[model samples]
Target: MLELACISKTFNPGTVNEKKALSGVALRLEKGDFVTIVGSNGAGKSTLFNAIAGAFYVDEGAIRLAGEDITFKPEYKRSREIGRLFQDPMRGTAPHMTIEENLALAYLRTAKNQNAFFSRTSKAEKQFFRDRLALLDMGLEDRMKQPVGLLSGGQRQALTLLMATLVPPKLLLLDEHTAALDPSTAEKVLGLTREIVAEHHITTMMVTHNMKNALELGNRTLMMDSGRVVLDIGGEERKGLTVEDLLKRFKAGAGRELDNDRILPSE
Candidate 1:
């Protein structure tokens, strides 16, 4: 559903601080594929995401969604086809808006009307929103009138996840969406992620620093280093791999020891 061809990005080019963030990085994801990415800081994981999300233009190469070439599309234009969740729980939702209001906004994205106002929301629409919120099993449906700012981090992120997939965009981008939550909450959110993705069959790319999660969560795992994808594993191969196995692959792919202690095994 998504493809990146020979994508390369460099920051502060032609200067002393010129840093190559991506170098000829090519990747492809089929429909319904879930990919988890792992890399140390500066390994170009975020850069790859930003390139696809149009945070910045790549120094070279192309980005395509489905069969459309969106290499030069503005971020807002691309957003219509993409749902993104940031590490910050507050980034995707309006804190002052009630839960129903926020959901109405997301629901409108896939509606023919193209404009949404909670004040004018039909009874059936409100019911739909309520049903969607109920799926989270967080009792949010009971509190649809509550302002989102009143929610805890886990609640907000879960709500954000629902909003992102309210209409099922062509691709879902999750950048450590559970990184900020406590372990128990993180596990809940991740479990929710797996359920939602499987139910909706959403094509997804998740960038996570947790090696264990990277292997355990997605259909495919990508290990990146020095601005390039060094190891890509999937299917049965990925299922049989462990954190220690991935570490060994990283050493072989990058020709260096895996030194980042941040890539830890899950408890």
Candidate 2:
């Protein structure tokens, strides 16, 4: 449901600090497809997401979502069709907002209610938020009145995931969302991610620093190096893939041994 055509981006152009972040990077995702990405530092994984999210304009090429060209759309405008989660749990939610209040904002994405989100919610809407929070199984439904800052990192990220996908955008972008969580919590969040994405049939692209997560979580896996996608694998070829196998492919595509320095170990 998403396509990137020969996209490129460069920062600090024409100076010694000039660096190419994305080079003719082209990618496509089918409806309900979940693709995982892995790469070393400065591999353009996050840059690719930023480009799709409209954090900045691409230097060249085009981006289309569900057949609509949104290359020049501003971030707020594009947000109507895209949901994003960042590595930092604190980035998605307003720390001072209560759980239900945060969810109310997310619900507003698909909500036609012109009233301010902070205004009293209807009984049905409050119930809906409660039900959604209950799915996290974190007792957050009962703590809807508590500020988000009171939640643990894992709980906040779980809440963030719910907020991001609450309305099911045309595309979901997760950028190392679980990287900061503890092992058990990370696994829990990953499981929740899969369940939510599947239930909504949301097409997703997740950039992960965990090698095994890249191979294990999604239907397809992509490897990048020096701002380019060097390896892409999926379908039958990806069913039984392992980290060692991916390392081999990375070496072949990147012309060097895979760098494990930045990759998180499997839990």
Candidate 3:
């Protein structure tokens, strides 16, 4: 479970370049909810994720995850409960580290292993890592000794997804994680995301540019613009919804038609 209340953030306040990235943003997520976000550029989608991930403290509001206040929690401390993925495949893993070594680092960094002062690996843990990597079905299990830098973008992204969920954090933040991959590879990674999140009943939020994916992949969809959540749809309201319907709602909430210059890509 997660809750964000009255979240507001401003950059370069009181200056010529001052801009508010998020404004009075509020959201609640129940366990097992997969909410996909759609918006044009500068709509505060990634800002919301960063605020929750402790990339920076919000100028206002509070954030709580799994019953603890993390409003001012340090980024490293929040890592134990929050798992995040970026559009860049190289962001989360060590390029020089072997496949199993990367997995061990993530496995050891989570809350369950937080109390242990020593970062030790055993055969049992390696076997567990192998089993987890095998789930990707990309032959990574057998390539455990290879450095991550040797992998293709899609392979590394899939491996990052596995690492993020190897322990199933309290919440998962995905920032257009598949946007940079080829269509075929992106489809594969998206399928893996659906399976792993469903299997663990993880509460997750994903930022995406593709409108069709926003509607189709997750149980709920949120539309944000100008730093505020403009539309939140789920259940019957979201069922059978079309891209046209979503655009109309965006207009109603944001007091203008969706920006054409920053159009959301749809299939």
Number of the top lDDT candidate: 2
- Report the C-alpha lDDT of model 3 over 165-244, residue by residue, as the tens digit: 99998899999999889989999999999999999999999998888898898799999999999999998889889988
Error of 1 at 200 (Å): 0.9
Relative to the unseen true structure, what is the C-alpha lDDT of residue 215 in candidate 3, on a scale of 0 to 100? Answer: 86
Residue pairs with backbone overlap in model 2: none
Clashes of 1: 0
lDDT of 1 by residue, 1-267 (tens): 998999999899999999999999999999999999998888998788889989998889999999999999999878878998999999899999999999988777656554545578799989999999999999999999999999999999999999999889999999989989998999999999999999999999999978888988879999999899999999988888988899899989999976767666665
The C-alpha stretches of model 1 lying farther than 4 A from their native spots are: 111-119
TM-score of each: 0.96, 0.96, 0.96
1-267: candidate 2 lDDT, tens digit per residue: 999999999999999999999999989889989999999999999999999999999999999999999999999888878999999988999999899889888878665556656456688989999999899999999999999999999999999999998888999999999988888999999999999999999999999988888888879999999999999999999988778888888999999976768786454
